[model samples]
Target: MSRPRLLPWSNVDGNPCYLLGDGTGSSYLSRVADNVESVQLDMAEELLNHAADLLCDSDSDSKTTSPQLRFLAARLTEALRDVHRIACSRGARLALPDGDDDDDDDDERTDD
Candidate 1:
């Protein structure tokens, strides 16, 4: 029997789950991963917004001792770690800003 492709998420037993797919961006498993990543990112954004609101409040430092604040921070940290792993596994790259230069030419081209 062919070995199943391992998914990004784990099963109930903390074992890696497998799916049938070619691993390309258009594959079924890949699509599922993409959707999951999107939701994870959305959750992260919301969490950050909430945290920001809390921090911006005048009584934020006093409120930080609350259980709810701690829970939110813990959840956000877990989500961050998960998203980082997913990004690494998917080989996602961030485009770096161009250096301070007047020439705005593409790097791929060279003057021969």
Candidate 2:
């Protein structure tokens, strides 16, 4: 048995979810997770763009209202949480070199 994969979303109670697998990433749930993560990342990108637009507008005479800014902040927070979860899940699944369990070197490298 292999280490269980951390899922991108939590349970109804807000606890992290996991998927037990045999190491091969061909399971149905794996595909679903992949799709979901993709969607989440895309949404996050869109939200970031919207936030930039809102802030830019606020700099001009078309000032953004307090309620609109509040709503945007809330959505940005949710998007950030999803993106963080995806990063954690993917980072955990990365394969390290054999006989090298320490990830100190990884700190110097950035994923493209």
Q: For this target, which candidate reaches the highest lDDT against the unseen true structure?
A: 2
Residue lDDT tens for model 2, 24-100: 88999999999999999999999999888888764743677888989999999999999999988888888877877
Residue pair clashes in candidate 2: none
TM-score of each: 0.61, 0.83
Q: How far in Å is the alpha carbon of 61 misplaced in model 2?
A: 5.7
**After TM-score superposition, what is the CA distance of residue 79 in candidate 2 from its true location, in Å?**
0.5
Superposed model 1: Cα runs more than 4 Å off: 1-6, 17-20, 92-112
- Which window of 10 residues has the lowest lDDT sum in candidate 2? 56-65
Displacement of residue 95 (Cα, Å) in model 2 is: 0.6
Per-residue lDDT of candidate 1, residues 1-112 (tens digit): 3334445688899876666554345776678877887888888888889888887888877757678877887988988877776666555333336783436566668889
Whole-model lDDT per candidate: 0.70, 0.88
